[model samples]
Target: MKAMILAAGLGTRLRPLTLDRPKPLVDVHGRPLIEYNLLLLRRYGIVDVIINLHHQGDALRAALGSGDTLGVRIVYSPEDPLLDTGGAIKNAASLLGDDDFLVLNGDTIIDLPLDALLAAHRARRAAATLVLRHDPEQQRYGLVEIDGEERIRRFLGRPAEVETALVPYMFAGVHVLSSRVLDYMPDPGTTFSITRATYPAMLAADEGLYGFPFAGFWRVIDTAADLARANAILEERPPLHFL
Candidate 1:
């Protein structure tokens, strides 16, 4: 299996900290944030990794060149004018090849049963399976509504209307995507969001887009406070099995 860490963001929210490095390179308890995701994928035996680079990208490359220290073989996709999620995936289509690959946010920490998520994705034969979790701030983060069968009835605000009594969940920024999804994406080099543009189109066409329910430790290290909170939480009791 292959994986891509969406690490190209300028991370405007992180401010001065990100002024020196990319969001994924920001320190979290003495370790770069992206290192956790790299180690997490390595733990699950997914070693082939692709990282899209933009802001302070050279620094990221300098810090973890070739991914040898991290136990993963990484290739970088350098984007001068950064591509959004969907565009990033499309940009690295050649590296990802023709298989189901994992996509995750570089600035977040999440610990869940990856095997179970993969099993569910295959069982459902979904075109894509996003990791969804209940968050009181679902609307704040963005609402990802799912039906009884776990089909994502709506993503963010896409498909604006739905009669079904959909349950809202927050997108964990992790997902398994089939190679065929590339068909639904814009032309290569185009900037677009997978959730905002691609997924909704797939949903409209009745393509299977499902959600994997996750109830585990998850945090988005976006702001300075978020970074601090993660460190505090981890310091109290190391819950991450990989650590």
Candidate 2:
């Protein structure tokens, strides 16, 4: 399976650091932030990666050229005007092909069980499966409600679904989506979000969307404080399991 790492954001919150390089290149531990993502993919045996670049696009290629040392083949999709999550994927549709592919946030760190996520995605036969996490700030991030069967019933509170006893979780910025999801996107070359635009439409159409509940280490590197927290955590407990 192929994976696409979403690394095109402006990283405006990161300020000075991002002013130097892209968010994915921000130093986390000894490797670039995106290197951890690459290592994780190679660890799970998914070596073909598509990284969408916009902010500091040249630095990404310069840092990891051909991906030989890292053991993964990278295909870059440069967005001149910048595409949102949904549109970015749509732009790279040719590289992803017909198979269901994985999308990951390039600036976030997560020790996701890729094999398990893949298995659950296939078993549920979902059109898309988002990795969900329980957090006090779930609402702050965005509320995603899932049924007892692990199927996503509401995305960011849309379609006006009845309230259920099921607990809501925040999106983990990692998901496996069928290529068919691209069909739900707007006109070609349009900038839109998969969660904000395509997802609600899919939910209204009754397309299967599920969630994989995760209770492991996950962190976002959007601000200096967030980066400091991640660095502190890594110093204390190294993820020996990940590559």
Models, CA RMSD each:
1.9, 2.3
- In candidate 2, stretches whose alpha carbon ends up further than 4 angstroms from where it belongs are 157-166
State residue 19's C-alpha deviation in candidate 2, in Å. 0.6
Q: Looking at candidate 1, what is the lDDT of residue 15?
A: 96
Residue by residue across 1-243, what tens digits does model 2's lDDT show? 999999999999988999989989999877799998899999999999999999999998899888999999999999979888888999999899999999998987888889999999999889999999997656556568888888888875433244556677888899999988988987657898888889889999999999899999998898999899889998899663675
Question: Which residue ranges in model 1 land beyond 4 Å of their true spot?
Answer: 158-165
lDDT of 1 by residue, 1-243 (tens): 999999999999899899998889888877889988998899989999999999999999999999998889999999878889999999999999999999998988988778889999999999999998887555546468888899987776533333446567878899999999999987889999888899989999999999898988888987888889989987886658876
Model 1 scores a C-alpha lDDT of 0.88
Global lDDT of model 2: 0.88
TM-scores of all predicted structures: 0.95, 0.95
